[model samples]
Target: MSIASSAFLATIPSPDRGVWEIGPFSLRAYALCIIVGIVVAIWLGERRWQARGGTKGTIIDIAVWAAPMGLIGGRLYHVITDNQLYFGEGRDPVRALYIWEGGLGIWGAIALGAVGAWIACRRRGIPLPAVADAVAPGIVIAQAVGRLGNYFNQELYGGPTDLPWGLEIYRRVSPDNPAVEDPLGGVAINDVPVEVVHPTFLYELLWNLGVALLIIWLDRRLRLGHGRVFALYVAGYTAGRFWIEIMRTDPANEILGQRVNVWVSVLVFLGAVVYFVLARAKGPREEPETLRSPDDPDYPDSGDGGAAGSPSGTAESDTAESGTAASGDGDAGTGDAEAGGPATRPGSASSDVDTGDDGAATENTASTENTASAESAPAAGDPGAGGPPEKPGSST
Candidate 1:
């Protein structure tokens, strides 16, 4: 085909390169996309987590562990299930570990990521189901963003199409063996002058976005909790994956004549549906745990589910605020402790006593008897102040 003919097709073109080098470091579009997706997930998760009474750092901290585990799980699932691609007679087994080349199973990632998250949640004394419910929508949004990596990799696209929205795949050639045909097709697409295929990645991306919106909307409207929201997310995502996986023309393992992923999606969707239904009977919504960072004053710590005040002992802690703290009054004036202790007011510190009975010095003590007697005493000029002046004669 002529260059003018190719230009007339007007299709989305794949990136010329998926990786670039700067200094000694190599940056890969696929890896960058995953990293950005994880970051977005963590940011959004943090908001939802806070709404659920979780602390600020919980989402990021859990992600730190979940991301690597998910990556490993995804790669493990891909290599193990699709071993033929890398472990085939002529293929190099080492390439199986080349995750930057783009092959991650969402099912495996979620499963393993949840395990990692559970560990983090356990350490923080948080329930895993609660955390799962909060982050469900954000997780799907991250998956949506991850599809961009497939776009750059020029992989996981659908069959040939002539539509205006088709994705233009560059000529795929077998460098090691020119005789080898493209795994996606029986024929050598490299010989073809031009190849335009359906942009299945975009299809899945849009679907994931829709799923994310649906999960969020349902979560808010239904007040879904106790992991039901997470179940809904699983169901919604698998529903989309079932259809999208069918559209993809990439090389995938087949089981019972259909893609193994399609079966997995069906199984997963059923599990999610059952869980969502059963969870409804358990409760409508989870009580957001009032338990949060004990140190974070701004974070909520009350079980009341309202604007939280101070820590757990806040109301009770006012005991000290109401009055000056009780301590031995050592000195006549301030009673402040010197190097040894409060500068003793003569014999006062010996047994919680006060040297002088003037209401001034006695007030420093925690004693009830002295405080009451001092209060009863009247001024010198008052009737009761002199205590019957003639009574002094009888006592003498």
Candidate 2:
């Protein structure tokens, strides 16, 4: 197809160039897209994790391990699955290490990235399932963003299409050697068009974003935890991937006349669904206190209630002091009565009795002793001696 005809067809044009040369450095849009996606994933994961009662910087710390491992894992999957592209008789095997050229398998990236996350979780004394649940939405969003790289690279397109949203594929040639057709290290020239194809990358990008929103909504509504959110994400992504994988026209290894990814997606989706259902037995979301390490400053101690400086301990001490003071006052009143003197109650005017004769003083002392004895008597059949009254038949 000619550029003039494609321009009149209302199709999405592919990027004219995916790389830029600046003096001594080269910048590839694919790499930039990947970097931007990683940053977005980390920022979003940190926010979600903190909201879920995780430590503030825990996501960032885990990303330091997961991101690198994910990249390596993605590259390895691509090379191993498409071994013919790198290990063929005429192909350069070194090209397998050129990740900037664009090709990352999401399945491999997730599988190996989880290993890195597990290691980080273990070191920080955090549960891996909680971390996975917190970051599931962010991971899907990152995948959506990374799909833009596939757009710029003019790769992962489907068979020819006449739809309005069809992607225009322009022939690319090496900038230094115009005669050499180099898709990865080349730039489109002469405004020419080769074909217009279905934008499968765009389809997957939109599907991924939709799945992210779905996961977030379900997570909030159902309060999913213990890796259920992550499991749901996996199931949702693979469901879309199963259809999208079959639509792609790219050369790939096949099993039973079907693409290998289609088979992988089916198995993974079943596994995720099973895990999601069985995970219900794990109980509800973890509380904030349980998410913290024992050494954390805000961590709740087991001995908090009776600690010396704690509120409950201070209250107990005050009650004991008050009881001792009351007992001392009771003993003083008894001693004064026994010595044949009127026992003057502290804060009572009636205690100021006339002591002109010994008989009057003896009478006052005897009356005080009788009143004290009556006031000190317990209720009938009370279990506690001189204690507060209780209703009949009530247990202590």
Candidate 3:
């Protein structure tokens, strides 16, 4: 056999599936890794949420809004970037919404998912930066899982290498495919048509997970806030992506044999660096916005006051001023009518006169007090005298 044959022989993947068939379905490592990654992301996010002084319910609230958005965003990203794959002959772009078939771009997912999370956080009255920080590590871990998905799909591999740790091609991509190879000169393997590339997916997975662990550990020890850890995550993951992009043999339009993602990684890494520098220079401080107490007048007690009833019961309390019961009674039908009656209205003729600290001074009493005075004195027999008043006179 020729040297090319020997090289090709070394690059076959070791089929290592436990081969457990659950009835009619098959569970693969790729699916398992992705699921585990999502679970881990949620766990990490919840922990970070609490650390940032968020309510326990915040995670559930956020997930309710974010999960679907992220998934949809990710699918959309995949469809747009690889439009030909989904829009080609006999293909239904609508089916592109089907995520179970599995095509997601990390960048697209992150970008759109971040928006979803921001809206959710805003709705929950949580600070956006704090939410961003909580999500940072999880995103990295999720990317790690996503890379494993690439491995299962047998795509996104790199150039050939003789290294002991080099990935073997369980499945090879065609050079004719624009996605797997660039339009170029002839290159054959083992005197046969084959393109065995590096397993870039696994490399990315391990690196991202490693970076995530590092960020999490450092966050606990350092107590960095304002998404510093997350910024570091972006920086670190981009750094790894940069390195892997160099080794990637996937069909890509490369400027100087470096893929477009390589340049993107550089730009992203620089951004992350700038962010980290600014964050450190500013000296990490807790965002004042996140520091809200239950008693805070402006603090949102529950769902937007647009709900049927405000949780603070301010509406009910205000109603109490109108003769309604001030207690926690839930009744409103008979109570309102009774409370509105003259019998319940204070200072009314039928009710006890309202007295201040001084004394009761009703409308009539006030008018009488204004008229009476010492100067205008009435004599004892003023009625028979025909004079209204006399100065110090008691005789008639």
Give each model a TM-score: 0.70, 0.76, 0.60
What range of 10 consecutive residues in model 1 has the weakest lDDT sum? 387-396
Q: Which candidate is the best by TM-score?
A: 2
Q: TM-score of the candidate numbered 3?
A: 0.60
lDDT of 3 by residue, 237-350 (tens): 999998887887755555676666688789888998898778787566564325333444544332332211233334532333222322212222122222221111223233
| Candidate 3 lDDT score relative to the true structure | 0.59
Write down the TM-score for model 2.
0.76
Check candidate 2 and list the clashing pairs. Answer: none
On lDDT, the stronger of 1 and 3 is 1
Position 77, candidate 3: lDDT: 68
- Cα lDDT of model 1 overall? 0.70
Candidate 2 RMSD to the real structure: 11.3
Per-model lDDT: 0.70, 0.77, 0.59
- Model 2, span 271-309: residue lDDT tens: 999999999999988766456554455544323321222
- Point out where model 1 deviates above 4 Å: 1-8, 172-193, 290-396
Which ranges in model 3 have alpha carbons more than 4 Å from their true place?
1-32, 88-95, 171-197, 253-257, 280-283, 287-396
| lDDT: worst 10-residue window of model 2 | 304-313
Error of 3 at 112 (Å): 0.5
Give the lDDT of residue 222 in candidate 2: 96
